[model samples]
Target: MSPSTYRQYEGVKARRRWITVGLVLLAAAFAIRSAQFGNPLIHVDENFYLLVGDRMLHGALPYVDIWDRKPIGLFVLFAGIRLLGGDGIVQYQVVATLFAAATAFVVARIAAPMAGRIAATVAGIVYLLLLGLVGGSGGQAPVFYNLFVAGAALATLTALTRPERNAWDVRRQGAIAMGLIGLALQVKYTAVFEGLFMGLALMWASWRTSRSPARLAVDMALWIGLALAPTLAAMAWYAAIGHLDAFLYANFLSIGDRSGAEAKELTRRLAKAWKALHIPLFAVMLAALLEPWKRWERGPATFGFALAWLGAAIAGYAVFGTYFDHYALPLFAPLAVTCAPLFTYRPYRFGLVAASLMVLSGAIANAVIVRKSQLKRGHQAEMTAMVNAIRPRLKGCLYVWNGDPLLYHLTGSCLPTRHPFAGHLNLLREHGAVGVDQETEVRRILAGRPSVIVDHEPTPRDFNFAVVAIVKAELKRAYRPVKIVPLKGSRLVVYERVEPK
Candidate 1:
């Protein structure tokens, strides 16, 4: 009640808040460690990212020397890791845990206003636990990008709602939010849709306070441009190097060029993800919409904001249409935020308890599934052994005819072609001289006279017919098959060059 007593109370509260952050971070490390430290290499995409990063650190350029659809910032992140020189995937996992913990801390802060401290703490832990449920546990783009998105969302929420703050303060917070969103976009373009949602929400807040249509339009335009600057900067960098068309084609047109799965297959994937994560997802969603409605008075706009944010996130993922389980990660933060109602509204306390148990248990279950799918399946070890066997014999570039980008990283050889993952050159999906161009590239790679090559035999339906023909013919003329290594589902053949081109 007195000034001295109140100051002491505030200091104690601050210390307690820091302690909670520490504990939640420990939980994050444990969650990611338990999920993937056992096998670690569940998905090849993460390794593909590392391969590009490693190449860039060695003075090779991305989109020119190494190729993928990943945006520039993702490459910079892994490139920094490669430069730092931590041993293998373990370093990546540790970084991912730190990001996860940071995200959890952000979620807690964002929710603290609506739900009490206890509920906010629960939200942080729940978000960390749910990260393990997705198929891409560690090193996934979402694992890193979600932290930025959550931070952006939190900053925007504060900008709009903190009535005590002056307009200049709110504007500063708005800039911070937009800046975070810009960074998130460079990590993954999927952040664009979520950025749109946050922008609309902030504009609504601006209009509410000022009630000026012209100002809202002008201000929103300025902020939107600022947020999109990273993407534009990337385009300019590539353009300056005369590869702007390459950047545009890779980031924009390449995905559209691929043939999508049939509706039936997409439906199956959607159903499986829904069954795995949606029990908790739906419970929280139902509670959020209905619980506030039953309140004698209309619930606060924060509740509505949570619902809309969750909807936008879900829609952001769904618009892509193919549901890899990790794509479900963005849904959890907003879901966690909205589910704070379970703690506040007595009627839905059961939702909190039920969802918490599901998420925590599912984390373990997902880990086991990944281990079985990758480790028990047995090819990863075999592939590693093959690369180890051939690493000594190869002197220059190593080409994996129909395999993953990780070949270069594991074997310690440079990639002969920027299109290291030969699947992209397959005849079925890509059009517009893709087939002709790839055949020419393959022959060009062969002309370099690499000491070693590894590839698999592709059936008619399996690969590009022309590329496969070129490979077979080139081997017969200039190279000899030295060893055939057996894997679980297929075989890998290593070729040694016998004669010059």
Candidate 2:
């Protein structure tokens, strides 16, 4: 080989090495930043997931024992964490840190071919920097799903760029890509949309290379079938256990059943957030679209498929109808690659550094502002006090009605009700479905007569106010309020059943 060509190859390898080191550093930074205050379970959702995971570790299946719309793969990760001796919130944060790093590595890999080393590193850095920005903390579904989704995308890109004239090799790669997506599906159903986008891109790329529509169509169908294995296997397990119906409801219908005017509120919140974040990301994506020819003129197929990935990610986020800030995390992967021009374009290379600083600064500001203090001093402090003050008063199971799940774990008591968190049940009530009806839950509460009932009211309709209204009335009749501990954004009132006069 010519010395100049060899030099270029060496240069690529050196850039990759630097990118690898940068990703490792950024990941470490993420871990430190995440633990900056403490474990990153900013939302009660993490607590709930942790609770469910612990329950599953004790042999309880999701939806049957404790109900949530989260896919099985989510609980599986949590259960695995439990087995690994890191079942607490701190352990969850550690796992999330690793996932953030692995995903950034995949982002860099996808970007390296099309956008070169600078863009590649930028992609990785973007992911690492933006993870904490959404405030999902360490254990959000996206934390894990992003890694699986990106790995799947990488596999798809690999399949698309194969130079092997061997058909079996192409099919094998395609199946692997789809299989990774299948595993992603198990993490969260949102991966399906991104999977669909990759599937189409793979088909298009395959048709271009093989020029045999019928053959490719057959193989693609098999690849799709391969993708369904994880989901299908899950269904079979639930079916075997005679809880398939519950499985369907939790994974599919529960989310689908959530309807009504609340969706508008979610959209509005999303819109406000989008305005703040749009400029830097949109500018990069716009560059990708405008310079489509340049993006795919050489290198691997990451650029083209990344466009699909972004579209699919956006479509998934929009159609899901919930606009939680963390929901926006999936957008960063495609945005990073699309932003390649930020580093490659001489006029805009400086903009890359500037935009990153803005993102980092903005994230820090948000974390500081939202955290209300250092992580340790914030909600964790309140919860610690609540556990210490309240655990002594508890004799039996703990009941958190429309309140944080950490209370259950912190208080070290069993769950008193199947319906724990109000996040989903509130939506079900808006459907006018008896599925989350107040009467049933009220009966459970009265029957169990939980030793410590924590009633939290920070926001209207944050709980099933209507049903919780009934539950509260019953608790008032049978129990007396023990303590009201005010915490950030929420206050907890502990109720113990009144002893007979």
Candidate 3:
């Protein structure tokens, strides 16, 4: 070929690659745009995370000043975003969008060698679309951590496939992969399952390449240590501050103390998630089972690796025993890669059909959520009104008993107690789970005489009635309802402390 013609062809290929990346990012932004900047009530968990992060910036330590079980790394992410600019709601949304896009890009990269580029790109887009259906439309933990896990997978895949590389080179790649897994662990401990799988896979690859058993054992130990480094660093910091026990309990031990949901409730959640997510689930199963074995470019080994990754993700989701829809976010990337070949299988195009169904269903589900937020005035106007009302009256602090925890950050008011997340103190399932007495925490918060208190009426059925009764009694005694904000099928009543005669 002529030199100019070769350069021109390369240029076109580069342009097409950029275009494909742009498309994936655009899909992620579009899918998650509904819950960006002003929609603080999209998910209560993120709201609290943002609040804890904001407070952390002002010298409040998590597990010490603001209590929750989320790893400190997640809060550090939010705090870092808050450090960049205002309020941090928009910043975190933007960061989450980028993370989602990057994760999808990694999915495409992992699948492109096995499936054609077109098929791989479709897999990435399908992943972004499926996220909204699985409650990952906003800044869920998986949204951030999935990117790390995907990177680890990519690194491990590259090392496994390149057996001609020197032993040191392979070890280096293994270390990088394990380090990424360690970072993921800090975002959510569930990444451990995937990390474990990838670590073993790396060891197997080394052994297959004729490494000695003693060397393999040493390599495994090094990789495991690398994977735990981030968590150990975090523990060391807490130990220096004399709060290691608090960190230990919140990060490791607290989950076991919580009560489990009733079997019926757990089944109901699992059924609901299954109903919403069956199309993608079926697509994953069909692709894994029906793909022509001879067509895979990397042969059965690559396909098996992807399938094992998916199994690890499923184990991560199931280990917690709670089947919340968002808990399934870890599965999307591996599912996408595992199902990519279906997009290019001769005349079937089953992947395209599944993608279409997923996009349509996901769009409809997100539309309903956005419309409900709009109708209830919970996204911007309602929250703004509540914040304005409470901000002016805040002489001491703001207590969010049953409403959005974002109120603490928005109102810029001090917290009444360390347990700001309502469920930790109010949910029957968390009666003794939060490493503190629920009733005592409620009393302590009320005794602080917060300037404004936010509570939701028609309490949720699963709330601890004892804690609810304590808050209600105190509200009646020393606080008067001042502002009522309507939400979806409920009201957020803001109360001001009553002055003595």
Candidate 4:
């Protein structure tokens, strides 16, 4: 081929590559656009995260003023999003969409070498589409943290493929990967299992090139320290502010103290998650059992790494014993990459069929989930009505005892207590799990006499009845039922304090 002709061809190829990436990102945004804004109660966790983040902007500390088991870094991300523009919900959703898209791009990049570009791009799109099926349509913590995990995997994979020219270059890449994992840890601590796997994978790669045990040991220690640095820094900041104990208990100890669901309930949840996620899970198992490396010469190391990452993610999800479908979010990225080769393999056509089923099933499931979520939580009109009803009656702080915590943000009312998340204080599983005693905190919030108290009728089956009893007594003594805003599935009962005549 002529030199100029070859150069022109390469230029066109590069532009097409970029265009494909742009298209993937656009596809991600379109897939999740339905749930982007004006839906405050997309998920209880996100609602509380947004509330905590907005509070932070006004100088409220996380563990000190708003409590949750989630790492502080997640709140910081939301706060940074709020700083960018209007209501925190829309901004965070946009940011999460970007994160989901970026992670998909990385998924494509990782799979391209083994699977053809077309197959790899399909893998990326599949990742985005499946996110909605798993409650990741909005700013779920996994939606944000998965990008960091994918980036770390990409870094590790790159280091694995590169010929050992400079040992330091490989070490540098490992450091960057560990740093990314540390950041992911801040978003959600479950990233630790994945981080540990990636760390060991990097060390294994280092050992291959450098045969010195001492050097490997030093490298391992440095990577572990890097992975812990972000969490330590957060703890140090809390310590400096004299809230270190609060930080430690909420972030670490609280999880252990929490009670687990009954065996039947847990099994039911696990089975449900499996039903929703069976496609990807089955694909992962097929890839492992088939041993794709044996059939494709170029796939041994990459497939091994991807499979191990998927395993680590599954371990993380199962470790807590609570198999909420959203916990499977971290698995999607690695699942997509691991199954990329299936799209192009001609022998069994398993990958192609799986991909088609996943996309089609995921789309229908996502639509139903979004519609139900909107119905159950109410749309913008319903939210506005609830807000308006409570705002005027709120003479002081607002206490969201058993309803959407987003009211705390939308009503522009002060929080009645650090435990703004209703489930943390109301659920049977969290009776003594949160850093503060549930009964004492509820009493304190009641003593403060919040101007408006929001409660939901037909309380959850697992509610802490003792705490509910105290709250009911207080409402009877000092509050009067004012408005009942009917949601699709339930009614939000707003109570205003009785004024002394």
Candidate 5:
């Protein structure tokens, strides 16, 4: 107990804190760099939204002109890019990086109040690492949505810890949290689950301390109402135009019904979920679940709330129940928060470190896979060149097969992109799957009488290639394949419909 011994002990503890912080910083640096090092803005979904946004730039409605189930915010945000300048890949990455940094800060803020400063720093770094692993490049909306969700969680945590504050403080914090939730919903409705959960958690924490049901109910109503107001206003506005049908029927109902697609069986869905977590993360989640129970007074509230949030997010995923890996993005916040406690205990710190290393390793592996995949195909660049070459040649209409984003990005136009596999909509129905209306749909597509068809080669064995095949078949029947040329490291097959010229 001598002064010298005490001083030595303090020094060791300080070093441990610095070391952890240093490691966390290293992880953040890796995440930022990883985002900058990826492919161009030609991802499948990115192309779809880029095209939609390009159309909106010209005052074309999404559902009325093209087709998709994405929320309006997604389109509007992209549309803003077209508004300000153009839809270049670099612009998309810039916005993505900014939003991602904000999300990391939110995680740190949420964890700082619950755990110490060091732990909070580590949680933020962990989130950034996980985000780098999952969020691909080029203006992906989900990345921004994830950032908003994290911000909401941080606001809720602040409200919970400060429940004894004056009315103004509670109202301000509660309202901020509620508004974040609403904004999250505006980005993606799946965000609604996490938003509502956080809102309720904040209200319950305030209620537990005050012991007045009336006070609790009123405060809860106020926050929830304010939070949801933006989303309601957006819906009302979109509804005023005939576009409401597209918003509700296509986005909400059609997307919800996509679960029954043959590719979305429950077994496959659960399996993909497991793969996404991997063994190490699964362990972290288990540790997080158990850690709360051990803390007794603090453990019950914090861990129980985490469990509720985790369960709700999982249930939301099950509802969509598609075998897609991105469905798990909404769960990342709870997963990261709940798993953070594992780092506090010394023994668990080793596991936490191990898990982080595994995540880092996985990121490196993914980057390698991305490189290899790109080397295997030259079609994307070739397709881009083909579109550019054909741009001046066609006058009537240009319909892109496979709905490539480069088409719109290069052409500076928002025209319909035909799908070859749309005929499968009928097949999906024969199998009793709920799908988009293809009967009226096919006729609507041909109505454009596209003067040219740009068909990119398909990814080997992807079901989406069915659409590509359908386009090729229809083109072969009506038009002769004029020339199959190679450009920009890939092949482009151009078909010009025969006319009595």
Candidate 6:
């Protein structure tokens, strides 16, 4: 082709890429805003983040001064957003949208070289839709982690495809891969699965032996070093804060040994996710799988990289006892990548139809599930009102027990007690110091000097202490009962400690 023709072709390709990115950005922004507008009240895990982030934003040092189990990487990301987000939900939405968009772009970049632009576009769309459906409308670290995973996959694929690339260039790709892995680790430790998968692909590529084993060994070493850099930084930060134990024990160990019910619940969720993707992607995958393995051989090493990544991911997830749908997220990218080959086969259209239908059906089912799980707005409003009314009259600093996270976020106070007052009465006996435990626990709290116990719906169990009973009898001896406010068809009680002369 003539010089002018070449320039024209390059310009067109550049414009197409820009357009692709723009569409991804627009779609992600819409999804994030929808999630934000749907529910702003804190949910289970989000509440924990809200509590931790609130403290961190307010000058409380994590690890050094406060107790939380999140890795330093997540804390840094949340802190940066919270600092920039202030009190606005829009800020969170924006961060989430940006991450989702980045994830889509990563998907496209990874797919383009393996499949054509058409396949890449489809993959990007698949990622955006899947994340929105699974991640909900709100932006969270999982969404960010998904983006990083995709980026790592792209880098891994590139490194395998171009073994002849210069040592420095290969090292740079490895560094990018490792950096992405580090970011994923910070987002959630479960992301270790993603790193493991990518690493396996890298190792397999190095072993392909078109080159001398020594050169491959040298290349592998450089790449491994780049990847370890981020994790080491996180560990160093943990050591600096004297939180290495908490990182290792509390976060990692606790997740490992979750209760039976938690494990079962996670398994059930994963089963549902498997069905969601399987029914739709199966047809396409079969065609791709049946195609002459020789056809795949024609591509640069991305095919092998995809195989190793998907395999390692499946194996890693299986090895871990704690299972969640989010844990299965890393697998989605490689599966989707592998699915890209189906679009090229003549019969693959059948799979696309099936996959599209499954996606739609799964999305509808997921929406219903999300809706059922949401707390009624009236319930939230009622709880907030009662807590606000009783907070002022209560003595000492008010702590919320078994209360929603908003209470902490809105009130900016510590937990009512580690042992939630909820329905569990035994918590009262277990942790509530009568003359002795109370004297110690209460004195320690008072040392920092806050009074007042605000609790919601005490649980029923051994030593199950009713909030009403605690206020009326055991605690009333020292705390004055102010009022009981009914919330969302439930009850919230407020009390103040009587000052002793």
lDDT of each: 0.72, 0.70, 0.83, 0.84, 0.60, 0.58
**Predicted candidate 1 versus true structure: per-residue lDDT over 102-210, tens digit per residue:** 8877777776666656666776777776766665466788878888999989888877777676555556667778888999999998988888988887777777766
Looking at candidate 4, the ten consecutive residues that score lowest on lDDT are: 289-298
Cα displacement (Å) at residue 305, model 5: 3.8
Q: Rank the candidates by lDDT, best first.
A: 4, 3, 1, 2, 5, 6
Residue-wise C-alpha lDDT for candidate 5, range 434-498, written one tens digit per residue: 23444445445555656666654433333343444555566766666555655335555666666
Best model number under lDDT: 4
Prediction 5 global C-alpha lDDT = 0.60
Q: Per-residue lDDT of 315-419 in model 2, one digit per residue for the tens? A: 998896767777887887776666654555445555566556645765675566455633322456666666776688777887776567767766668877666
Candidate 4: residue 491 Cα off by (Å): 2.1
Error of 6 at 96 (Å): 1.8
Error of 2 at 316 (Å): 0.8
TM-score of each: 0.86, 0.88, 0.93, 0.93, 0.79, 0.76
Off by over 4 Å in 2: 1-19, 22-32, 162-166, 289-301, 352-356, 373-377, 424-436
lDDT of the structure predicted as candidate 1: 0.72
Compose the digit string of candidate 3's lDDT tens values, residues 1-501: 999999999999977985867686566666556454556676788888898888888898999988888899999999998887878887787788888888888888888777767777777887787777656777999999999999999889887886466667668889999999999999999999999999988998778765688878878888999999999999999999999999999999989988888999999889967865677667767776777433866746666788899999989888899898889889889988887777766656655776566667766777676676455536777888898889889898898898788888888777777888888888999988898899998888888788788888889889999988998888888889999987668888999999645
Residue 63 displacement in candidate 5 (angstroms):
2.8
For candidate 6, what is the lDDT?
0.58
Q: Rank the candidates by TM-score, best first.
A: 4, 3, 2, 1, 5, 6
Which stretches of candidate 3 lie above 4 Å from their native place? 1-19, 26-28, 31-35, 348-351, 373-377, 499-501
Candidate 3 vs candidate 6: the lDDT winner is 3
Cα-based RMSD of candidate 3? 2.6
lDDT head-to-head 4 vs 5, winner? 4
For candidate 2, the clash count comes to 0
| Cα lDDT of model 6 by residue, 17-115, tens digit | 868665865674465345444254424444455556656777765544444445666666766767775553456657766776777666666656556
